[model samples]
Target: MKRNYNKPTQGGDVRPKKALGQHFLTDESIAARIADTLSSYKGLPVMEVGPGMGVLTKYLIASGHDVKVAEIDGESIDYLRYNYPELAGRILDADFLRLDLAAIYPDGQKFCVIGNYPYNISSQIFFHVLDYRDQVVCCSGMLQREVAERFAAAPGTKARGILSVLLQAWYDVEYLFTVDENVFNPPPKVKSGVIRMVRNGVTDLGCDERLFKSVVKTAFGQRRKTIRNSIRGMFPAGVPLPDDPLLSLRPEQLSVAQFIELTNLVGSSR
Candidate 1:
């Protein structure tokens, strides 16, 4: 279905504002392609973040899915409600990060999340999704190419950091195709890419989560330092260094499994 781009009756004319990180996607083909990536799972409740002018929202609703949107921009929310009356009740005017994610779906129901996210807050939204993994089936978002690469980066790579370690612990991230800056109304400086992350339930690595987070943070806090030096104060004063094979490696060199092993060791020794 073709989207109605006319101005809304409720709100006056509003152009993309840099202050709100509003970059309206004008390319319908790119919008369709992003929609197609999430097409496999139809009939699932979809929570779209920053649905500027209902570009992707139009396609998602057209594909026979229940679509709800969380948009912070009042003008965009007005435009969406005016153009797509079907989504009037579903569209929420609130910060995506502040919304109650668990309340969006019914008991035992999982939802798919899609967005052409604001570059400024893309990482923050990813963490929100991570916090509510049980309610989410998967997530597809448009992010700056650099950020996308980090999400899909491998161990020992420079892009790998706290995000890689934390996100990889619970989700399998994939770097999809990249899109040019010209695709948006007011082009952004950096090229953007689509990223998809599917939840893989956290595994029991025999460690306290608090300790594990502390261990990972400390290890990566000084990436060049060995695990022993980086996490010196993590264990009790009298406790000896762990003999785990990974203790000799730098933070970037350790895989998720090795991080789990280190966390387990730290937890047990405490």
Candidate 2:
């Protein structure tokens, strides 16, 4: 469903394209809440992804942090430039996933990431965040409620699966709050959820991090199967299994720590 816009755009108004998955957030309170999530990290470098119509972005700029906006939509970029003239040079006309983040900020810079993320690429965004775990101190965003819940879900629950295990291994995830379906420009079918993930103290997983990720993905690839059967390919030949109860349980039953322990055992065999 495509619709016209009537904001302060440089070239008049533009239509909200469905292909871009643009659902401009209209609630000021929700925008404030999303912005305030990064209040504790004051004066730090920050970037807001997909700042459509600058709903959440205005508050991010107002927070007085060195805020740069990564927006791919040319229409929205023009609107942001016209409405927020102060964010002139800071407006990055680039896709966030393709951005050279290190080139944007000073050397050795770590920053917070906040946005009303487009639902289509939300998971990809999280994976990109993981790639820079050392530099991204915090990520607060709005996304599909189901995905947010999955991030916050505990081990042994159905929601605890691939992303749940992988992200929890490093970041401490918190499902901050839930938002209703009526807040967007074109209301989505399902409700939205806001979640915050902060970089935890654990810099290392104490095992082969790559193997740990592989084990988690492989196990969850067949959630119903026991870890032994799921990760059969992890070892070319038969290897001694770890002396842990987790091996007998399905992938959903293992916590992040348990997965790490298993990864260490499996990695030793390989």
Backbone clashes, each candidate: 0, 0
lDDT of 1 by residue, 1-270 (tens): 344556676324558889878888889999988887788789688999999888898899888888899987777876886789999689888999998888777575899999998999899999899878777888997988899888888888988877888788878888989999998878999999998888786655456777778888899899888888888788899889877667788888877888888888787787
- Cα lDDT, all candidates: 0.84, 0.85
Candidate 2's error at 113, in angstroms?
A: 0.5
Instruction: Choose the strongest candidate by TM-score.
Output: 2
Q: Report the Cα lDDT for candidate 1.
A: 0.84
- Clashing pairs in model 2, backbone N/Cα/C closer than 3 A: none
Query: Once model 1 is optimally superposed onto the true structure by TM-score, how far is the C-alpha of residue 105 displaced, in angstroms?
Result: 1.5
Candidate 2 local lDDT, 1-270, one digit each (tens)? 342434664323645778888887878999999999999998688889988778888888788877889998988877887788878898888889998676776585899888988889999888888888888899989999999999888987889889988888779999999999898878888899999999999988899888888889999998888988788788767565666677789988888888988888787786
* Predicted model with the maximum lDDT: 2
Candidate 2, position 266, lDDT: 84
